[model samples]
Target: MLAAMNRHRADGKAGEPVLTHRFLCPASAVSNLRDRLRPQEPWRLGLIVDVELSDLPHVLDAVAHDTRLELETVELRLPGKDRPAHAVDAARAPLGSTDASTYLELAPASPAVPDTLAACADRGFGAKIRCGGTTAAAFPTAAQLAGFLLAAVGLAVPFKATAGLHHAVRYQDPVTGFKHHGFLNLLVAVCHAVEGADPKEVEAALLIDDGPTLAARARGVPDHTATRARQLFVAYGSCSTSEPVDDLAGLGLLESRLA
Candidate 1:
């Protein structure tokens, strides 16, 4: 999951969450997602709509009549059959276009990416990245997304993620069919990247083959891992936190960093 860092305009003060045009594939729960997050706490209700190629029309219908809609981000999945370009258009059409807050998830492309980096540059849409789960962080995983980021930080293609980010540790969820959250890994990697870590290392951290080795090295950073991490998610997601994120700002250690 790439961090969404807002840029500071000439004024010096950081601006709003830069809404990107990219749409994450398969948006999460829309209607009652927030109420579901924490039953006890006070939270604003928002929707995370899914925009599959086949489901685009349906989503349009749902949101068309309803102008007072509250949404986080529309995630688009690039299935073997779904045309990524078309989906991007559909997702962006609803969004106001040029909203950097928007993001897209980059699942492994089928047939061939046809120059994914170039495609992203050409399309000028958000390319969501899968950094965890069965998705490899390199070549076709987070590495690919990182490439987009590293190569085009000035270009402005944003990212969003889902699935596989549950625990903040290196594990797999049979239910979700992706690697569970390796919290420490995410924190270190993001921080490293923020601090100017090489893309190769970020890609290495996202690889399954290299996970064990990375995990061994990560044992030391548990206190900073973002697994079930609070505050940060709230700060980032903006929807209120339930279990994973409630007070991340005050909390010192993440699941991995807790020790």
Candidate 2:
């Protein structure tokens, strides 16, 4: 994975390779940290640990003050009602100098989600929405996703997405038959949302399957819109970083940074 990232030269420094993005490691994924550290190439920009809400206390106890790890974010899966608040409260006491960013994952339709996002924004945290999984149930419907985007935008909260977004355009996975949200589509939709586009308009953008057309729209996003959208949409995690980069290149929306 590191080799692939380096070959892409996404760090914008020829022959001076870096990850160009933060590598998210699950709390238990110690080997990833070791491998990244071994390179000693500044390959990682930041570290985010995925922690379960129930285990946050223990997680914090273990790493809250560990100077070795420059922890930037913690994404917590809300176990139940009001759990987002619980996670935020649990994290606040030990926030320390890291100024750790936090995100809560919740069902888009959950009644408590809007309030949770609002509270998270007020507390300087954000939200995370699961975009896909091995099963269809893991994916949010266009309406559901639009709702999440609207709520986040309305509350001035930033959010990140995870899983099953391996392609640039929305399409059905040949193996799973699950419709996956396109990473480009999501980015463009967020750009629209940051510009105050309605949920219906954002949903239409998310449902676009034409890769080039969607890429064109995304490329046309203004510099200011990109900045704000980056703040609100933040970054997403993908199992294979190369795939999304390849898709972007295919759409003519990206250029190789290599000299």
Candidate 3:
């Protein structure tokens, strides 16, 4: 990945996209990953730790070795199926002093979601949601997702999403039959949530499956609203870069030249 980034920088084409890398690993492996990634200096690196086997302070110390590497978020994975709020409270003391964000991979349908999001906001941490995964169970229903958005926005907590958002429009896989959340749908939903739209209207945006209709709504978002929406949504992870760009260009949302 560093080699690819270096090559892209070497090309030096006008208006070339900036490349960044996000590494997801266990807390114990952070030091090793930092050592391996240190040679590539001045790169924007975001780290997401999935498990907390090691001390968080140690993990933060490892990230400190590389000035460019940021400990973006640490996932609180408690055993024995503890509540999400418990996990958030357990992390407050150790993570309180650091600027690194913390999140729990809690399902929006979980009864603990509202309290968990509230706890996260109280501690200055962000929320993380799984948009989709290999299994159908990983996908949250439209209403569940909308409820989460409304809660997070009301609390003024930023959030990040991961997995199964490679496409621009909502779709169900023909083979696996797992419905995927559209990145475009998420963007519009965030805009509505920030604008104080009602819950039903926000959920309606997520339920829209027509590509042209969703694209038109995305284009209709004003610049200021989009910027404010992004501040709350923060970031989302996708496996393929070209797939989303292609989808956006095909929908007339992005310029063909950029694609």
Candidate 4:
């Protein structure tokens, strides 16, 4: 993803936050990170580290050796069954006054997710949703997606999404056969959320596949509404940036050079 972004920058400088990499407590992580950094790439924006609560100390110890200094964001993935507040407190201790923003990613199926989201919002931490996965079960149902986004909207908290989003509009993968959410679907759904759209309405937007219709709806969004929608939806992770960019170009959402 970072490589694609670097390839696209007209000035040849990295200018966007691409994705987050989990930091394991192994010795190899240090060397792996060092090898990952390249000259003139926006290393900070390209990859943020996600640290598990129990591994925070170990990760901190390992990172102390790196010259990267402060991380852009140290995402704390909360323990699946622990109390939200307890987990937040434990995660906060290791961060200790760093300039990096804190983001919390957790399972939406957890009964306490809403409460945990509230706690994260109160602390100004961003929220993350695992949208889809390599398998079908990893994907959240429309109800689940709507519920989480609606809850975030009510709390005025920003959120990011990951996995299963590889196209501009919803479609089934030819090889894997798993149905995936579309980035445009999500952006439009987010615009609805920003304008206080109901969960069903947001869900409706997610399931739409008509390319021109969806593009028209996206274009209809007012500039101010688009800004607010972007504020809440933030960004998402795509395995191939070109796939989505190409999809958008094909759909006329983006200008095509070949046209």
Could you tell me every candidate's TM-score relative to the true structure? 0.47, 0.81, 0.83, 0.80
lDDT by residue (tens digit), candidate 3, 1-259: 4553444345333332321244445666666655655465544445555545346766667676668676665655432355656677666655546665666566788877788888788767788888888788888999999999999889988888888887889998899988889988998999999899999999999989999999899889999899989888877766655576678778877664554
* Cand. 4 TM to true fold: 0.80
- Taking all chains together, the TM-score of candidate 3 against the true structure is 0.83
Model-by-model lDDT, in order? 0.41, 0.72, 0.74, 0.69
lDDT of 2 by residue, 82-124 (tens): 4667756665544444467777676786777787887788788
Tell me the number of clashing residue pairs for each predicted model.
42, 0, 0, 0
Compute the lDDT for candidate 3: 0.74
Evaluation by TM-score, superior candidate among 3 and 4: 3
Ranking by TM-score: 3, 2, 4, 1
Which clashing pairs does model 3 show? none
Q: Which candidate tops TM-score?
A: 3
Distance from true position, residue 70, model 1, in Å?
A: 2.3
Pairs in steric clash, model 4: none
Error of 4 at 34 (Å): 1.7
lDDT of 4 by residue, 1-259 (tens): 3354344443233222232332222222544655665554333432244545455666555455455533555555665466887776665776656656666776766677789888888787878888788678898877778788888888888878877887888888889888888888988988888888888999999888888989999989999989988888877766564576667767766543334
Instruction: Judge candidate 3 at residue 102 and give its lDDT.
Output: 65
